[model samples]
Target chain A: MSNQDQNLAATVNTTQGSYRVIVGRDVIDDLGTELQKTGLKGRAFLVVDEVMFPNPSRRAQEALERGGYETHVLALEIGEANKNLETVQIVYDWLADLLADRSDIVVAMGGGVTGDLVGFAAATWLRGVAVVHVPTSLAAMVDSSIGGKTGVNIPKGKNLLGAFHQPKLVLQDVGHLKSLPAREMSAGWAEAVKHGFILDAQLLDTFERLAPQMKALAGEEPVAAIRRSVAIKGEIVSADEFETGDHRVLLNYGHTIGHAIEKVSGYGTYLHGEAVAIGMMAAAGIAERLGMIDEELVDRQRRVLENYDLPVRASGLDVDALIEATKSDKKSRGGTIRWVLLEGPGKATTRRDVPEEVVREAVLAILD
Target chain B: MSNQDQNLAATVNTTQGSYRVIVGRDVIDDLGTELQKTGLKGRAFLVVDEVMFPNPSRRAQEALERGGYETHVLALEIGEANKNLETVQIVYDWLADLLADRSDIVVAMGGGVTGDLVGFAAATWLRGVAVVHVPTSLAAMVDSSIGGKTGVNIPKGKNLLGAFHQPKLVLQDVGHLKSLPAREMSAGWAEAVKHGFILDAQLLDTFERLAPQMKALAGEEPVAAIRRSVAIKGEIVSADEFETGDHRVLLNYGHTIGHAIEKVSGYGTYLHGEAVAIGMMAAAGIAERLGMIDEELVDRQRRVLENYDLPVRASGLDVDALIEATKSDKKSRGGTIRWVLLEGPGKATTRRDVPEEVVREAVLAILD
Candidate 1:
């Protein structure tokens, strides 16, 4: 076998439904060969985020065309602000006018937002159709693109509108990260940190040890780090694809507050990874305040996040607006906020009936 | 226990997540009892279609209020044309503004269109709030409401923007059908006929025998027929909620061609059931032409559909337009149409690549 094939075999595995996640550098080069394996028919509709369209994604589209797939480009606006029911319709209309069928595959060739919106369209298009994700951003590569969490945002909450539709394959090319902005790359690191916090204490230590390298964006380790993070998410999702039990809910560690922050900030004010970074810090603080964890652990987390310049504190935002947003969080039940708190490293649990005052205190303490 | 309660219990078993299909007269009176079972907190957001707002649904709403659930009515335009992303956003904004929480439930009180639109809103509201379906129209009562196939239409196709969000309860009051238009009632019968064709041959014979009763909108058996048909759809969906296998695809027996007709004609040109009626006839013809089923069965399906005044032919529609619409069908894979053809009674298989010429011949024969 060729060197590239050997690398792929080491990095990815095909499951029962033939769903696979391909990881490595220059993975986009193998798009045509992978599409052939999926047995999908017709042309490939390349749905990308506006930010990634003119740069990193062009080569992938050209490769698809060269592979004999009829290709159409549906460039969507980037960020969570555009991840809504309305935007989903726009992409659907474009594909419909193109006469896309089940034989065709929708290539989500950007970050989390693009992957989610297009994947949702693919899930519902013609009942459903095949989808291949070529996640271009760090967050997309490490987290969003792996789990099959495809959906758009509802005005009331993020990802409120979606389905559990898995992709035919996910091609993560680390080369795409070279084009990502510095802030976006830092945001993506938050998810990698999240993986460590929720499942692997050792992974957290690894992040701390590699903080200097990750901050400098140096070494081939980022690709390997991202692949490991994605594999962790994949294992969690595959065990409970529907989130019907606690396994999937544990993955929501900082998201309960993180989503509220995004919603109140109108989605784009803070990048998802940035907001999640602060939210995780707040959660760790709350756990400490509640005597659930030690102060040293919180300090450790804060120091590690500081290395990447991720915000672990909130300031200059309307506190009441944030509170209101939290109350409106999709996770709220009977008007009570549900916080997913870390009991210790690599362990988490959802704590509902969390007092509004206690939550406010947590937010206030985190404000600069 | 009340007489209706005892009667319902005899046929339907309600579980923790299981909803009830309330059939027969004055069933709206039980709305209060059903709401109690939904575990809703305080009030309900009652979403109704314009047609039903002035009729039986208003009575149902009154009944819900009397049963002690604070009620708020959200009246939406009727018909498939209005089931879109824009409408869902409007509902989301309204619900978010109201601060509706998980303790609250969205009561979708209308036909299939309203149920689909509202159910989708509920599914996305706060990541998903409890939903209770009060299906007034026969089509919804027998099919849409029970299956939990909640979604809105995208400009590209029908139900292309949606989620498989099951409702907390399904309240089907067959008594409400007395106010329905004859064409509307006939439209619903087509889906019931589809259920029989897919699963139970004896049910098909029963429908054939009761064709006159169905057309005249007479007899108590219509309620029983609706209950049985809903149960069949419920069982199929419950067994394979994601349509990952053959069992659920059988539910699309006539839908492959029916959806094409709907798209070509525009969503509201004909009621969904009406299109399905014609599509089923076309499918039967194709089956017989392929020598997969006896010609006598095709005639039987035609007679049964005709008795209900359902259009069994594609006459007057442009053949090319219909074919184009069929090609855009959600069931098409890799640019090839996947037709669910009946090999015999209660036996259907997905047949791909049944030549375009054969499909055209069937279409021409039906048009004739």
Candidate 2:
């Protein structure tokens, strides 16, 4: 009957079965209110990263308890390197011992790494239990927390061990971004920019206009920006929930090169989105060199990324190492490198037969 | 077309992803001939147990290669103890490093452990490649191989870590049973008896009539017996692929207590089906005592199992220890033990609300 309840009902209806990507300023403040709607009985397990728990974990626990739900917080070690089988086993064992059940929910409250590790643990524990994600970082807000691609990093590659287990809800409180480090904030913007480049030209234009304010946003615009980016991701995923089509693969436009960079640089060295920014530039160069896109268009795209202070090149990295890393990427099939090439702004396509020479040329050009 | 091709087509339909369940004497001799029908290209990754590989690995691999398919034999340490994350990771990495592609198929050529480990490897490698199962033991062919429930064991519980990955084809070569030790053969029969108790009174009647011959031919069975067992399992799994209902859980009639026994006995000490044999007797006693099933029916079931020399009593095992291990079972949800209890022959139900005291009393009775 109330205005707030009406909006909640609409969002809940749209997000049924598929995860809801709730983007708004100060959404963290509504954690208690929103979780009450899930109607799950018993205590909640709040699995938070050690880095975020001192501030946000307590707040979340307090909110859940206030909403008449019992809460227990489990703080985990942070970083991509910690995402492995050993950690997953430890978490599963802990939950098993704790007797956590389907009636209880796991709140994965951290960045992408934490959400992935926790979400996967939730998926596998007791066959499966409900998991709600409150992604605090930008990369997680727009991308990782929404798609339900949950897994840990194997020694061979990132997400080499995982499953397609969607979350119950994704609470993207852009207010959390106010506390995020500038570099991390910029990394998140790269993904938002990626959504714009891949599907919506108008989103790109709007992002360009508000790019400066996004960097300086206390709250309002960043929340709106995240909402738009999440909607784009949700629509694409809803169309092709599994990565069985080109539309889904197009979302990986900058990721092929980005994952290669992340692998070569060591997972935590550059931050995922930063590596992706540089990778996107490399992709643009590859497309232009192959006569798929105009050289001027490549420059225009670089300028937009530069405005956000995201990386556009890898200055000292070895091109050969990047090439080798790209070969082992999870996306590659039967030894062929699959690259997502830009046709123009707001358009991308997967090119599986892109010659190795073209990939090498693109790497070298980006290095220069 | 050759008579064999026409017979194969008539027996099995490939359109519904349905394949034959070869269940007769000398079935292993037909493995090479059967695999030819799958039209699989490239080499076969022959995964066998260390024990079985010594004798049958050479023959199996030779047969595959002789039929014009390359064969790469991989022998794993035998038993459930070896099924863990380390083994899964090693197998997956080996497959990736070996460049096994979609065209290639993995042959899980051992017992339940091999089927599970290799099946999981196939499911996760390159986001799933094809797998063919060559279950050497009765325990594997009669139950494990047909269900498509592939996964490795964890320290906390058996099959705590796994996936619901089905095999491309299951080669139930009855000839492999010739090599099974008497104890192992009896262990395998426990599951067939379980199928009888859970859903098929006709299977129970068949077992009663053929008990002597089935025991005498511990290493050999008439094609009819094997076919009946496989058909029962296949029909159950087809109805409930993910065990979301009573149809699939009924297949685990004796597994709840069986898993506990396996865990308490430290996995390899007792074969999986052996544990299930004891678990089944315990469950039957519980059902009888609860007045859910008639005592005469329990006696008849005991007579059939005893004829095969299967364990009916939980002797020399600490009751408290067994109870503690059962609490850690994967079947336990929210700390409540879910038991698949039988009301009568061919009737089973999962009861979550059964008191622990009742379970303890039945275990004690079985021990006596």
lDDT tens readout by residue for model 1, A1-368: 11355334222322224466777777787787778777776789998888876766688887787677878887778666667766877878887788775567889998888888888888777556788889888888888887677777664555656665678888888778887898998899988988888788877888888987876657766666776787788777777665655677777777767876776677577888899988898788778878888988888888888887798887777768878877766666665666888888877777875677777888877777
Q: After superposing candidate 2 on the true structure, give the runs of residues whose Cα lies further than 4 Å from its correct spot.
A: A1-17, A29-43, A66-69, A101-104, A126-128, A264-269, A318-325, B1-44, B62-71, B99-105, B123-129, B216-221, B259-270, B317-329, B334-337, B352-361
List per-prediction Cα lDDT, in the order shown. 0.76, 0.76
True contacts kept of 1: 0.37
TM-score of each: 0.84, 0.88
- Give DockQ per model, in order: 0.33, 0.23
Residue by residue across B280-357, what tens digits does model 2's lDDT show?
988988888788998898888789888878887766677888888888666676688878999888878888877778
Q: Which pairs clash in the backbone of model 2?
A: none
